[model samples]
Target: MVHVYGPHIFHTNDAEVWEYVNGFQRFMPYKNQVKTTSRGHVYSLPINLHTINQFFGKTFRPDEARAFLERQADKSITDPSTFEEQALSLVGRDLYEAFFKGYTEKQWGCSPTKLPASILKRLPVRFNYDDNYFFHKFQGMPENGYTDMVGQILDHPNIEVQLATKYRRSDRLDAIHIFYSGPIDGYFDYEDGRLGYRTLDFERFHFDGDYQGCAVMNYGDASAPYTRVTEHKHFSPWEEHQGSVCYREYSRACGPDDIPYYPIRLVEEKALLAHYVARAEREKGVTFVGRLGTYRYLDMDVTIREALDTARHYLPRAAARGHMPSFLEKAIAC
Candidate 1:
């Protein structure tokens, strides 16, 4: 299969998953420290004390810092409902509007007020100076890049892959069962209304020196069109390069004909997914998997683990039932 998309970072906290990946490629230890253009000052992400102090233009002790934010917060907002409400309740309207509102709008193509609160819940208001982006137990990119690892994974003699072959379910393959990694909605030819999705646009630039100090920089201001820029060379800190490659990521609403990157599975989309799943259950010979196949955003590690689980669990069951093994079976069970 072609990796038409950009880089895929594989990271996980599971030991078994780590071991399995290590069998194919070595991993390098890397951490992400992103910067954001908030109000005008460049500050570390997750909005720690350094960011707060810089934004307000005042220094405060630990206790005073807590009190400073309390004043900014909307005391009247007893129960924060949406992302806007939560932001206003905790950090006041000005800061939230500056750093969050536009970025969220550009990323999801919807106002933060209209989006789910859980999406913005990941942000932190730190009293101390911990600038590390994610708190995950394990984090790193592949030493040899993702394309190489995937090539190695599919190198088994038992497996044969046709790179550009467009498959149809009705095609005659009398003895061979099909393992489909295409969109679920497409598999059924959109019997119902199309599912909603958000696709990304990447703008690449070449630079001589480090264009940005960090690998990622978030444009929090509402005026900026792109959400963030990622420097690929910095992703692999183990090797240094004279030239660096970077990508500015822009988010937009996906059309039915467009390549879907992230499924906007609001209440309506879930109902549609249920429909496709029910239809899949009726068809016994086919199995559907992967991001586009399932119409969901999955991290690389989770995708690999789920793939291995699908193979291991369904193989035995298919043999016992005297039917060809289908990767799609028992997916929901996992």
Candidate 2:
């Protein structure tokens, strides 16, 4: 199968899934260090200490840093309800409006005020000088690249993968099971409205030397056309390159013709997902798996873990029935 999408990084602590994937391909340890530009001040991403210091123009000890943020926070609102409110109550509206609001709007194609506060809950604020984007104990990219890793996964002798294989309900299915990773709404031909998604457009560039001095650089201002730039070669630092390739990612609402990049699980979309889930549960001879099937955004690690779990869960039922595990039929039907 073709990745079609951009680079995919697999990082997980699940031993079973890790072992299974590692058996197929090896990985290189790579950490994501994201930088951001706000009012021409360069800062580390996830709003770490360096970011706060740069934004506020102050240097403080760890304890002093905590106090500084506390002073900046508006304590009237006990619990943050919306992205706007969260920012206003915690860090004042300046940081939120300048750094988050515009970028969120560009990425989601909606104002941050319209989005639930839960969307911003994952954002981090480090009181120390750590700039690592993820808190996970393990993080990395594939040495051989994601396309190679996926090829290895589908290389099992028992597995048959067909690229450009369009699923027709009328296709002969007397005996095989289907593991579908297509869009949920598309499976039923969108009886209801199509689920919402955001797609990315990449602006590529070739440069002799480093362009931005970092792997990822976020343009926070709404005036900025592109949301962020990623240097793909830096993703794997084990190798050296005289030149570099970078992509400026622009996020926009996905149309029917566009490739869906991220599922936008707003309130209405969640209701629609439930409807699809119910329909899937009642159907037979199919198993819906992966990001597209599940209609939720999953990191590479979680996706693999879920796949492994699904396989394990269905294997026992298949053994009892004296049949090979049909990814779709055995699990969903049972």
Superposition-based RMSD of candidate 2 using all C-alpha atoms, in angstroms: 3.6
Each model's total of backbone clashes: 1, 2
Model 2, position 74, has a per-residue lDDT of: 80
- Give the range of the ten consecutive residues with the poorest summed lDDT in model 1: 325-334
TM-score of each: 0.86, 0.90
What is the per-residue lDDT of model 1 for residues 1-334, given as tens digits with 9 covering 90 to 100? Answer: 1122554555578888988888877877877787898667788878778878878887877788899899999999888878898899888987897788889889888777776565667778888777877666777777887778778988999978777776776763553456677778788887777777898888888899888877789999878899988877878887778887888888899887677887776667778887777787677677788876776667777777878887786678667765644334444322
- Model 2 lDDT at residue 251: 92
- Off by more than 4 A, model 1: 1-8, 61-71, 74-81, 171-179, 322-334
Misplaced by over 4 Å in model 2 are: 1-4, 322-334
Cα lDDT for residue 288, model 1?
80
Weakest lDDT window of 10 consecutive positions for candidate 2: 325-334
What number of backbone clashes does candidate 2 have, counting pairs of residues 3 or more apart or in separate chains?
A: 2
lDDT of 2 by residue, 88-136 (tens): 7777776787689878888888877777777777788888889888877
